[model samples]
Target: MLPSLLLLFLSIPLTTVTAASAAPRCTTSTPIKTYQKCMNLPTQGASLAWTYHPHNATLDLAFSGTFISPSGWVAWGLNPDSPAMTGTRALVAFSDPSSGGLLLLPFILDPGVKLQRSPLVSRPLDLPLLSSSAMLRSDSSVRDGAGLHIFATLRLSPNRTRINHVWNHGLYVQGYSPTIHPTSPSDLASRATIDVLSKATEMGPAVPSWFRTAHGVLNAASWGFLLPVGVTVARYLRQCTSVRPTWFYGHAAVQIVGFLLGTVGFSMGIIMGRASPGVTYTLHRGLGVAAFVTGGLQAAALLFRPKTTNRYRKYWKSYHHFVGYGCVVLGVVNVFQGFEVMGLGGSYWKLGYCLALSTLIGVCVALEANAWVVFCRRAEEEKVRREGRVEEHQVVKASIGI
Candidate 1:
């Protein structure tokens, strides 16, 4: 009976050991109470100072601090002899701006557990940071043991305004001390930031990005379609001697095409800008309006009777030039603006378009100016020849006594 009892006891010990080995080292995390004591071990050999990242970033303050290392590396003073070192609870502190209190964010270390949060639409976040990402901040990482020891640098985002709205924010962590559910582990970290800025609920620009992209493109396209019509009119004004039927046909065809295209493009741009309100979107709107008004006026000019005199034609030419150039300029400006809002990156598109336009404009202006100069020179020469012919005829008649 005594041998049987001894064998049962020995078997019990083996089963317990197996169960313990299979179980995780850490799984549950406890929150740090403000009243809880933070233990600091005597540093004999600590890892380099544990890097400190602030919860809220302030001007004139550095985002840094010290921490304990599990290895007792030299960075922080290590005392392997301390019970806290073995137990894993030490200190996580931030400096209090007033009176220099060591504000501690404490945690009982755990591993692989996470605390998730949904963004609050109505409540204001309690943070001094100007980053919108603070909405997703969690205290899961308050505990440790995921083998990630990062020197986090939490700072305010530089983006201030979106659709005249201000965004406030701070750091978000996963597996943070679960404020809502306390039994979760502590090894979670959020790589994606939440919010730094937001637009007002009533703003037109409060629409989503995909919607804005579609709309803005349409507006821009509408503006562009009108361009070819103006270009044709400009060419005719410069080259046509008589306003022939073909000239009017060419103008009418181009106008029809331009208006159709511009309308589609304009509608799209409005939709897109309303969807994504930003600096680029503002420009897109302004340029779109300008294109529409100028194009409308140019088309309307057809209703007015132009004078028959050559000089009056020149006068009409000035109006045509103004409207044509205005439409062209607006179309071109919006194209670049669209590309910018799309975040197409770098000066790649801008540079290419600039070089092409500059070359084309330069060639046209030079040729037009040369043509005018030659025409004036020819007129002067012809005037001199006609006068000389009259003078010669008069002299010949006098000598013949006729």
Candidate 2:
């Protein structure tokens, strides 16, 4: 019995050794998060996988993706708090446009990700880069035709396992071209993001779907669709002499209603900004305010409208026309800016808007040409009548011999 017990004890340690040796060193199959988009992003797909080893206080992270660009820049980053790119620690890799060789560096995404300025490559939060612990491998061969496949490993801050960690990761890429310099900010914006949660399907507080839907519908309808419609009515419909008061009333009614709707949409945008703590669309917000103020001035002008016979009427007409057109231009521009802010840039929303505006412009061009033709005919007829009257008066004077 004692010999059998000794044999069992010896076999246990041997079995443990074999199991440890066979354990997979890299975490690949089970990723904590994934982001996939059918859109033609440079990094077509990305994933995050991690394993924590308590013995050495090491956190192994695998940030891997497929880069379609043969050159330019590709990056993945972790944001400790919010998903905004400003506060992130990123690992960037690219084929140096100047050298034609791969270059990898760590960058801190601060002061926002911009396309005009260069990125600052350094450790964020003073985290040390464990150069010895890092490994970057890529498949750049034509036989692999799947494009550039990059797999990178990074060491996190020491004792990261003990701290409760909440993370979100983002992927960004810019394609290489002759005009695009490596040091220059990318002309093309390509990016995606996903939350890394400890528990699957768990997420932070999100803005309600209904609120977002209302905001989009209201703004698109008011600023993009209705404001242009109002402008068209004022410019073209009012030209019909038969309509007279009808055209004026229609113009006023449509302008008033559109302005009111736009005001509501603008208010909702303000509320949304407040709800979102760290997000701000400065250009969109500024343009929206300008549109609203111009629109309001137009509305007030109606209240103080002067009679046509009044001398100041000419001045009012000039002011009203200027402000009205200005409002329309500003409103349309801000709507496009809003699309980009919401990540709907280059989307079908923008395409639909362009199509609608183009149609309106075509109609205006046809109507304007017809108006000029009518005015020229009327002026020529009046000139002929005046000449005939002058000839008749001369004939009568000569016949009377006086």
Candidate 3:
């Protein structure tokens, strides 16, 4: 995992590449009705142009993609519903290493995820590939390697006057890694919208992109880092005699703030899930729930804190330690899972969290060492004082006897 992240960060700074048509290559002699848009990406970028012929019920799509490596896969697809991979009808193209010819196939993202595994098996699809309907051209616009130009003419339903508002996304697999398939998790990372001859203007994703960003940042900082910081204060700083009750108050304050932020972040995620019908992150959701529940338990425990003289004080301490640490671990793990779910596993968000967590661990280690040293010194002083008292008692007994 670490190596993959290093590789991703090393390769993510993308370069701009253009695939200019030498001349106007509209499908028809007359001015073609066309729509064009571009989406910038981390590894590469894509520009899509489509022409609609209402009379013939045909849609001509040209997808030009920049490539970081020459050998691998690139796909452009229309998802009938949301912009997720599981429901997309994709036109997949890859350079066959053995045959040295570009092979194009029509694939459907199925209900099951097995199709996303390596050695991608041919699957049944709703859209049939028209005879000689696919075309591939070399684009020398990219400096690192040649780009891929994929063009296809697809048939639309009869009597359909306007296109439905649908999601369009693209994917690229770098090099020929056997484990990586077209429908793999990483392939779902890049996407863009396509509006072609739709009467209702698309409003955009169910949850705005900015909202998702906020959700990730808030939860990761609160649950992942700040909560742990509060735990550290209660564990280590509370022992400092000089600080007295300040550490207790500080711990309570930080924990309260972290819980509030985490609650807001968790709510955003729930809203986002409702906004997109077919898209779901099951593991991320589960982990998030577990963290939230345990965190709530810890907070509620504060209300029933046992007094130091209470017979159940040991039980309360045990419960607090177990739940608090468990919650912290889950929160941190879920944050990483959220990053992957958002296609940001290698992004700076993950990097920043890692750096913060690392700093916290360093602080804990330093403080623990100082605490142990102070404890040892106090123990030594107490032992010496006891020895002195015993000597003085012995001397007084000897003088009285004389």
Candidate 4:
């Protein structure tokens, strides 16, 4: 619960990070030259237009992407080796420091760039390029938001009709070097394979929505719902003399089920993380890992539980209470973090979860108040019985003395 409170405080600002509005499609007409073919790219609200000449395999292309800010940089590139970005020979465009005009330079994205060992620098691409140029445009109807267009003419190999393309935008440039781009889902998924011979385009693989939904549901049920209920049962129900060991069994069953479901959910999260490389949610991942480890420890402690009459029973109970509550707190907090990480901060799913959790907390509060009332009543009855016995004893002593 303490962890949940802390998470609530931290998550207050996450609600403001809404998704960007839709971007307009790419326009066929350009100020300089016209393209024969054009297609809207899948991610980052970007688009590509090109004209391929079959005789000499000359290709004229224009890639357009929106700027995140005034000082940001945009890039478009082709990878001859594979469909990924590691080996891509790219052309990056940014504002020139001297003239405040558009500056275009070629860069090769190597393994070092992916590993972040060194800053990205400009160099000549290995591809056969006839010419390259770039310009900034402010037309909202053609390209929504601040936009930049990269134009290039490259000579391709004979009979080459397929090409892999990558494009991305960044928020900063240190001196003349462009810094690493944002690692959000949209940014990392900005690659596609396009057929120069036709209008066909295949986007890069993305994590399925159903998989993410399942992960969120399972974790929410286990960590967010069931675990708290189990803790509540143990805390309140066990006090009833009629329930006795029944409460213990109920608590154990609920906890075991919750833990099992949480294990599956945690495994799914790990799989998703592996599937989407170069994307990281640091706080969410850390909280998840801590909760999982703490939950596992709590589960394992049941095996070494001390006997009821044992001298170590009190210490064992203390350990169990501390760890159990800690796990519950971490689980609840991580569930909220999961919502933010999945970009469902303002979705109906979060609202439903919040309503259910609030209901549970309300139930716990009512039960706590009732338990206090029962305790006070019993204590008062015990005191009255003691006073009655004392008065009767005094009456008997007085009669015997007379």
Instruction: Give the top-scoring candidate (TM-score).
Output: 3
Q: Compose the digit string of candidate 1's lDDT tens values, residues 1-402.
A: 989966875676577566544533321122211211111111111111111222432221111112222211101011112211121222233223343332334333222212223421122223332321100013222222212111212233344221111111122222222122211111010001112222122223222223344444444444544465447455644454666656666766766677667777677666544433222335766877887888788778867738766467877778977887888778777777766655543556556655656665676677678768878988999999999999999999999998
If both were scored by TM-score, which would come out higher, candidate 2 or candidate 3?
3
Q: Write the per-residue lDDT of candidate 4 for residues 197-262, one digit (tens) a residue.
A: 886665533444356777999999999999999999999999999999999999999999999999
Best by lDDT: 4
RMSD of each: 22.1, 17.1, 9.8, 11.7
Flag regions of model 4 displaced more than 4 Å.
1-207, 392-402
Off by over 4 Å in 2: 1-87, 90-106, 110-167, 170-206, 399-402
Who is ahead in lDDT, 1 or 2? Answer: 2
Candidate 3, clashing residue pairs? none
Candidate 3 lDDT over 159-185, as tens digits, reads: 653432222323343343212343323
TM-scores, all candidates, are: 0.43, 0.56, 0.59, 0.56
**Residue-level lDDT tens digits of model 2 in 1-402:** 989967875676577567544533433542332222111211123334555545654544555544444543455555565544655666666565466566555666666344536545445344443441222343542121222323333454555432222112222334331112222111111233332223222222333334554676677778777877877778877767888878777877877788888888888777766554344567988998999899889889989999999999999999998998898889888888877766567778778878887887888888889878877888899899999899999999999997
Backbone-clash count (model 3): 0
lDDT of 1: 0.41
Q: Give the worst 10-residue stretch by lDDT in candidate 4.
A: 13-22
TM value for model 1:
0.43
